[model samples]
Target: MGPYGVETLPPGVVDVPAAPAACRAALVERDRFEWRPADGGDPAALTEEFLLGHGLAVDDLTRPAGHDPAGPCGAALYVSAAAGAAMAGAPSGAANPVATLPEVAVVVYGHARPPRPPRRTEPGRWWVGPWRDSWTPGEHADAVQAVRAAIGRGDVYQVNVVGHAAADYTGDPRPALARLAGLPGARYGGTLHGAGWAIGCASPETLVEVTAGRVVTRPIKGTRPATDAGRRELLASAKERAEHIMIVDLERNDLARLARTGSVRVDELFAVRRWCDLWQAESTVSAQLADGIGLAALLRAVCPGGSVTGAPKRAALELIAAVEPVGRGAGMGALGWVGPGRLDLGLTIRTAAADGDRLHGWAGGGITWDSDPAAEVAEAAAKAAPVRALLAG
Candidate 1:
């Protein structure tokens, strides 16, 4: 029945052209905005205003000190690892702090447009050239040794060492991104495109997810192949297990700041999970938000996930910057949706970015004192192989 006794639908009153596709999420061409840390503006504040402009509630969001609250809403979010480090004032290995990319890239769409179908593409038109590693195997090994030295010096317990690879490609990279989004066991997988660039993320780790009112984060730390032997090896290795626990602890601490007193809990601990051909140790830590916890506060607690940065995030980031040759562009960041009172982001581990004429990717593992340099280097290769193979075709 209709409200106030009106007919739900009066007979034969339909539009001649019918209606829009209700199931599709298309875009308006000019909705994307990129925020660079070097720009001397605030991403969180801009986001709050963007949501407010869309008529969403911003009063519930946490505001910067001495700043007033505004409204905010639906947006596509991409937070680069370098951006996170830059915000924290962590040193970067590269001379440029935030790289050429924006620290935070946002696409503000309230789903007001009609659907746009995929562009016409030839089956074999896509081309990804051979990859060139930014750091040779010896260099990667040296980074691992450096991390071990840091641990020995009592500077850091562990640090994640990542290696970058780049290649030239022709044609659109969206096809490659689409293929990656469909990878097996991808919980929070998708592609986000910005000015002259795009990213494909097939990461299994859940950086953070907020639903209803509860917040949760899954940090993945240790990895081995998805084999019977690999499973046993991963579960049995004291080094792997210890490494995994350290990250789990770090996540707990990160979330505790925002959590209600005595509301934090570890739902799952060091469970082996499969992501394509690899097995990784992941833990689930969840907490109930304290009174009035907002989007900016949540993002501040856990972007550039601890699993990617290693234990004691600040020190690890500094050491990592000094060790790694190139910056971690789109890798080791967060990507996902942010809507009214909701956020679900995944860490960019097995992720690749297409910038200008080049496609870039990075992979690596946590380096503890017990870490073997050669093994760490090989592990990074193993993680990156599948993405490279999928893009090659």
Candidate 2:
């Protein structure tokens, strides 16, 4: 049993209805904090009342959320490290605790935030509806151009293209997400439903897992449908090889910033792994972060992963900032469970976002000098299929 009032349950276990209410109470009862999500509730306002009611500093509340472009990229909220520390048996904020949040795996939890009905500033609100807008074909083309430029400079070869579509929704996102889960050849697949209207189903090929003192990151660079077995050579072609190497090198450098000098190493190079929906070639990079490296540093070091951003990360980021039409709120963010002395996070990809009435999602492919604009455009559309079909009907 934990002081926070949660007890350990069995694997594939779940907490009862009272769990979330109690967890919310733990923060709301004693602190002035807010847990607003893309959906709507104002945990901040509730936290304020709790702080005033109890004797606590509002700053004591910490936010344990971030953006990842590869897995379920987006902003997330969680019990701060301090909050987790205060609660006996609670995991660190850096480690994702969603799975343990009572009924997360079994019952659909609340949206990332809460549903904001209608207001003067924003009037559209709905329940479980298509809430996303599509990017024009030209804009999509420009994105392809940007990727080509990166490839021309030998920065990267292929980057996955994710298009954005927003929606206002109600009801459990599980059904929508389950549409793609376990799809043949889709590696690192899963859905992360938040407390708001935000939800995403990602078929990530990358893995960032932490065990004991070791941290491992697998940068997946090649992609082709498993059904197209004959295209293996083309899928892992020379151009894709260069792209994988660039990102792998960038990852090595990023880890070096926090990892012990000389401890960083590439465990594997261009190994092909088949998943539910696709076949991918990925390289593994491992490192030992310096003693006392915190979550913030580790994340900051490799955020907006090289696979999406290109090599020379800072430059690619500048490019993204210049060309991307909107801020990638949660697109390309990371999500997963983390615990004391251990953590596991996946890069967010194949995702969607929703507000009150608008639902959005995106898909794109990496472009190099050898890349075909037409192919890239088609790739983007292909990635959008799962979400588009969901929004259509």
Candidate 3:
């Protein structure tokens, strides 16, 4: 169950029959209002128009903020990196596994009627095949070097490059999802089951939160093993600090477009926090929303988060497309609830998406001018280790 007591909708009884085939059962909470493109329009545009027309009240409450008290209402959305790239007018290269997923899919929950809670039952383990990387270690290191070259040429200050991995499995993925959701420091964690595809997420990074007209976004950049010495190293690393601040500044600028002049501020900078076995550095940026700022406008300015894309977002995205071999499906997107009086979404970092017998996941870090190609490749492996282990069973 989510922190707010919001549980995933049960199977076989979803009300929204108009949802696309790829996302027919991407339900958030049962007995809540849902909105999606019936005849195939822009998902972002459709959602924005729906929110504006409904005029839902927004309040400043911490997420999983429980139900609305007066009533339960919220929206859970997932937009792939490919979808975000298309929306930002960045070129996405050839189709990959993620390309088979939806461009944008959302499930809005509304009203006081309690949603059906998921049953309490342990999932069964299944056999899994050996994991394989989309790009070999040497090739991944070469890609990192290419990113450093771009930074050297001043094409971009930082670029977040990712690698994809997959392993074949038999039987259900619920047991793996359960294990992932129980991971240490999992704040926004859940599973979404479609016809033949399912996405399991145990994300810790907050992409954006809107409550009581105040908008806040926490961007995480640096990561190290959860050790006393690792914490010290993270805090003292100048390269990590530089990359963190660049993304923070980019986030502040993105929020400023819909925020009142002088209302945007950095609340916290370089705060170390624990997620699973890693210590991550995060910065909080908040702003007061301008009057009449719709959800669409806000999403347009910050759909693909800066931390995931990197500084000079457009340039970084272009380079990412040219370097990375595959696309990021649900990984690095947003997942959480958009309620009547609040909205909370998490960056889909520690996430996995399953289609047929194959389960897919991705991991990477920001590449800067000082980034070591070999170290960067190692970082990707380290980041993916835990998730791979959970799914191995």
Candidate 4:
């Protein structure tokens, strides 16, 4: 759901499933701001051209009375981590077989309309078969140690290593998505179904939000259970604080590109927010969009958000590609709406995708030089528990 209200597909809206050819065709035919493969040309130069070609602009703040705040609108877009990595000039490696979603999917709503409350439905039972993990606990520990070694050698500062889990299910996932949407603090929760696939996300991190002429991104990096003692520990942990600050700096730099000189600032730092049973440390970095900045330029500047991708993003991507065996399909991407004068997207953590009888979910954390390998594995399990339980019911 959007911050102001719930947004749903109106009647007659069609679902375009995850297929390379069909998805590409749908984007080409409907999307006003499509990302082409970045050639050797400068990314900044290409961004300028793309924005100009689309005539995209923020809502004029000085509009006359009675004018809507959200100006001319465009389609809703979902860009996976792989697509975002490609746009950022990084490789996403091989695709995950279990979660075979498109690299990007765009839903074009030809006109702008106010969001309404989502319809409520009765809960349905979903019995999931035994779950399997991509990596054993010991293997995940070794991967964490490898990332720490890279940090020691100055190959990278921090890399977010993730693991995948999947289970077979026997019922419609829409009911499960509905239950997830109702989860506490589920800000960017929704479900999208296509021909043979469906994706449901109840993400908490705000990757990027552009309103009027200001762009704000809240990057969450630290986590602990929501118990009083856990909150205290997270607030006082030097290691977690260091990890959170690094990503905050990275986000500030990303937003600085399109921001007016000296206009970028960290609005909030190391703030604790609750999501389900966990308390996450988040920081808000924002900036005033430079004159003539468009959606394409903004997205290009701050995509594949720093929270999911570690600091020194290119290095982190390299390490992630080297260590993780499976791809991070729908997880760790931007999932939300993009419209005229308004853009809101959440990091696709705590998200799952279903293809046929299989339900796929992923979870992981940042591996810092001081990270405990065993503890990291346990943390991933803690993060995956809520979603896993939701699916099991």
Q: Number of the top candidate by lDDT?
A: 1
Q: Candidate 2: lDDT of 47?
A: 31
For residues 1-393, write the lDDT of model 4, one tens digit per residue. Answer: 111111332332222221122122222123333332332443334433543344333323111222222432344567777767776788775566544355665544333243333344455556789889978999999999999999999988888988888887876665565456556777777666544566788888889887767888998889999999999999999999999999999998998988889999998999999999999998889998777666556666676778877979988887888888888887898777654555688888998888777888889999899999989999999988888888676
Kindly give the stretch of ten consecutive residues in candidate 4 with the minimal lDDT sum.
1-10
Give the C-alpha miss distance for residue 45 in model 2, angstroms.
Answer: 22
Considering summed lDDT, which 10 consecutive residues are worst modelled in model 2? 1-10
Q: Per-residue alpha-carbon lDDT of model 3 for 1-393, expressed as tens digits? A: 111112432333222211222232333443322222234555566665554444443322322234443443445566666656666778654355633355566655444224344345555557778888898999999989999999889999999989898888876765575467777777776765544556778888888888777899999999999999999999999999999999999999999988889999999999999987899998999998887776666667787888989889999989998998787876877766665556677888988877766888989999999998888888888888888888775
The superposed Cα distance between candidate 4 and the true structure at residue 125, in angstroms, equals 6.4
Q: Which of 2 and 3 is the better model by TM-score? A: 3
1-393, model 1: which lDDT tens digit per residue? 001100121221111000112322343322556776566655656655665565545435332222112322255677888767765557645632223456687665433233455445456567878899988999899889989998999999888998899888887776686578677877766776655666788888888887666889998988899999999999999999999899999999989978889999999998999999999888999998787877666776786689989879999998988988788888898887665665677888898877667788999999999999999989999999998998776
Candidate 4 or 2, higher lDDT: 4
Q: If ranked by lDDT, best first, what sequence of candidates would result?
A: 1, 3, 4, 2
Which of the two, 1 or 2, has more lDDT? Answer: 1
The whole-model C-alpha lDDT of candidate 1 against the native structure comes to 0.73
* Candidate 1: pairs in clash: 51-71, 51-72, 51-73, 52-71, 52-72
Measured against the true structure, the TM-scores of the candidates, in listed sequence, are 0.87, 0.63, 0.85, 0.82
Q: In model 4, how many backbone clashes occur?
A: 0
Which residue pairs overlap in candidate 4's backbone?
none
User: How many clashes show up in model 3?
Assistant: 10
- Stretches off by above 4 angstroms in model 4 are 1-74, 98-100, 110-125
Off by over 4 Å in 1: 1-30, 58-73, 92-100, 113-124
Instruction: Predict model 2's lDDT versus the native.
Output: 0.48
The model with the greater TM-score, 2 or 4, is 4
Worst 10 residues of 1 by lDDT: 11-20
